[model samples]
Target: MSAPVIAIDAMGGDFGPHCIVPASLACLAEIPSLHLALVGQTPLIEKLIDRQPGVDRARLQIVHASEVVAMSDRPAQALRGKPDASMRVALEMVRQGRAQACVSAGNTGALMALSRYVLKTLPGIDRPAMMAALPTRAGSCHLLDLGANVDCNAEHLYQFAVMGSVAAETLGVRRPRVALLNVGTEEIKGNQQVKLAASLLRQAPGLNFIGFIEGDGVYRGDADVVVCDGFVGNILLKSSEGLAEMVAEKIRDLFSRNLASRLLGAVALPLLRSLREELKPATHNGASFLGLQGVVVKSHGGAAEDAFQSAIRRALVEIHENLPQRLHGRLEDLLL
Candidate 1:
């Protein structure tokens, strides 16, 4: 296969080019076949590139985007007002086939709105959903609709299940166990929407439908693909992140109580470090906007250099797997 080219929205995140530039350059250095198009104000991006020594100018190019989508900008404003925004320009590159994928740390709403408008959705997919691999006890699991469609009917949830299953399989899960996120694992526990979605999933041909999974079951790794509406998924994800941070801080506080505790902490440092590395959000920062006609990966807006690099790497993996095409093929068999 040929080397993949990725378009990076260098001006989309909180730190903009400062973080993205180094991340892009590091990815380029590590993967000689990778090419990057940094989209932002040409002069500013050029200056950053110039500051970094031994950069392979041949593989990295600048794509000028006169405007930037602010984090506070609403989706409608971003779609209509900023025609030349770095986020839009990068997605446009994917739509126009100028790049195999687009990676951005821009406003989530803007990115989703622009992605749907620019790339459209694959056949049989009503809307695009954000999917990410989160750390779980059984290694990891793919969670979807992470804030895409807040209001979803049973049909929409059903589609998310199919799409999520395909995504997991592509990522190396063998017939992944699919489950619906609900108040309880019992069939009579959830609201009307969850019950209806569960019914639809049960009937999906060839799907490894494992019934309802409570929120706690997610981390326990009870299912390989957890399906829920955007509202529920987003809240679950945010709460998990906050809880993880709090626990980590509490651990540190306990370790620093006294000299004896500090000594114990020293002895346990390596194990703690390993646990932190496994659970850190930055290690799993990239979230794929699935169902789009092309590949688009969203990095956390506050992502640091390594975190942003994880997002770029996610895009590269999708490019290599031809994720959009795989979904298209699977949808034809499952949906159509």
Candidate 2:
């Protein structure tokens, strides 16, 4: 098989090419069969590549993009105004079949809008939902509609469940357990939409359809795929990130309080480091825009070298799995 080509928005993230260029180089070194197209201002990307000694130029190429989508740019503004934006150019590469996947740490809203405009949704997919893997006690769980469609109907929620289930299976789960994110586990609880969506899921053919899952149940890994509206899922994701940061800060403070405690901290340092490695958000930094006709992975705007590389790895997995094709084929049997 030929090497998979990934298009990187070299100017999208907070650190831009400074971090992206090096991360791309690192990924190239790690994956010998990978090829990259660095889409951004040609001169700037070229300068970054020149700084690294022994970079395999044959495996990397630069695609010039005149404009950049700012982190603060509204989705509409980016779609209408920035035609030559790095984010858009990278997505275009995927649409044109020049690359198998596109990875960007650009504006999330802009990315979604431009992606819909450029690639369109797969058959039976109304909107492309954002799906990300989150750490869980049992292992990990896939959550979808993370800030994509804030106002969704029962049908939309049902679609998210199907798409999320397909994504989980692609990642190696067999008949992934599916659940709806609700305020309470009882069927009597939750809004009208959740109740209606649950009804649809229960009747759907070939779905695991495990029933309702509360917020805490997500981390407990009660289900392999957790489905929710973008509004709820975004708040849940941000809140979890904030709580993790607070706990880490508290741990640091506790160890630095006194010399005696500091000595004990030294003793426990190895375990703490291991725990941190296990739970670090950077390890799962990419979020897939599921339901799109092409593969596009979104990285956090503030991602550093390692986190951005994680996003690249996520795209590579999707490329290898031919995720868009799998979703399309499954939707025919599962949705229609």
Candidate 3:
């Protein structure tokens, strides 16, 4: 089979060129069959590419872009005005069939807007959702509507759950347990949106609706499919990331306290490593923009080399699985 084409938005993250370059290199090394089209200023990417000794320039290509949409910039305005922006350019690659998938760490709203406009939503999917895989004792669980559709209705949430379940199936989970994220485990606890969605999910066909899941429940390994509106989902995604970082910092601080503590820390190094690996933010790097006509993987804006590499790996996997077709098959509402 031909290698999959990945359009990398090299101008998005805080580290920008630096992170994209190394991450692209790392991804190429890890996945030899992958093809990349780095979307950004050609001169900058050329500099980064040249720094690598004897690297095959043919494997990696650049799509020159003079403009960039800042994260702080308004989504619609930036995307509309900056036609030459790296993110939009990369997305256009998918539209024109130049690439199979696009990876970016740019303005989340702009990315979502451009993707919906260009790729369009699949049949049965009302709006595309951002899906992330979270670490759990049972393995990584798929969490959906992570800031894509903030004002989703009942049907939106139900479809997100279905699409998320399909993704879980790809990850080898059979009959994944689905749960609605609400304040209380009871049916009537949350706002109108959650309450309505809960009822719909409860009656939704072909899903394993495990009822309501709370914030604490997420950490306790409550369910395989965690569903929420984009607003709540975005908050939870960041909150989980912040908590993970804080825990890692606290552990590192304990090891630095004194010589005796350092010795004790050395003894616990293996366990700490396990925890760190388990909680490694990069492990769950790519957030699948579920419901798009095509698969668009969003890498964290502040992602480092490892995180971006993880995004590339995810794009590769999705391409091979023909994820977009499978997702369209499951969520027929998007086509309407």
Q: By lDDT, who's the top model here?
A: 2
Candidate 2 deviant stretches above 4 angstroms: 280-283
Order of models, best lDDT first: 2, 1, 3
* Residue 291 displacement (Å), model 3: 0.6
Evaluate residue 15 in candidate 2 and report its C-alpha lDDT on the 0 to 100 scale.
86
The clash count for each model shown is 0, 0, 8
Model 3, which residues run further than 4 Å from truth? 280-284, 333-336
- Ten residues in a row with the worst lDDT in model 1? 276-285
Better of 2 and 3 by lDDT: 2
lDDT of 3 by residue, 1-336 (tens): 577789999999778988888788877866778889999999999999888876666788889999988888888787578888998899889989889999998878999999998899887677888888888766667788888788888888888888888887876688999998989997669888788888777777778889998987876778988998989988887777778878888998899799998999889866887777567553447888887877699888887788888888888888888889888776654323
List model 2 lDDT by residue over 178-207, tens digit each: 999998999899999999999999999989
lDDT of 1 at 32: 87
Local lDDT at 278 for model 3: 64
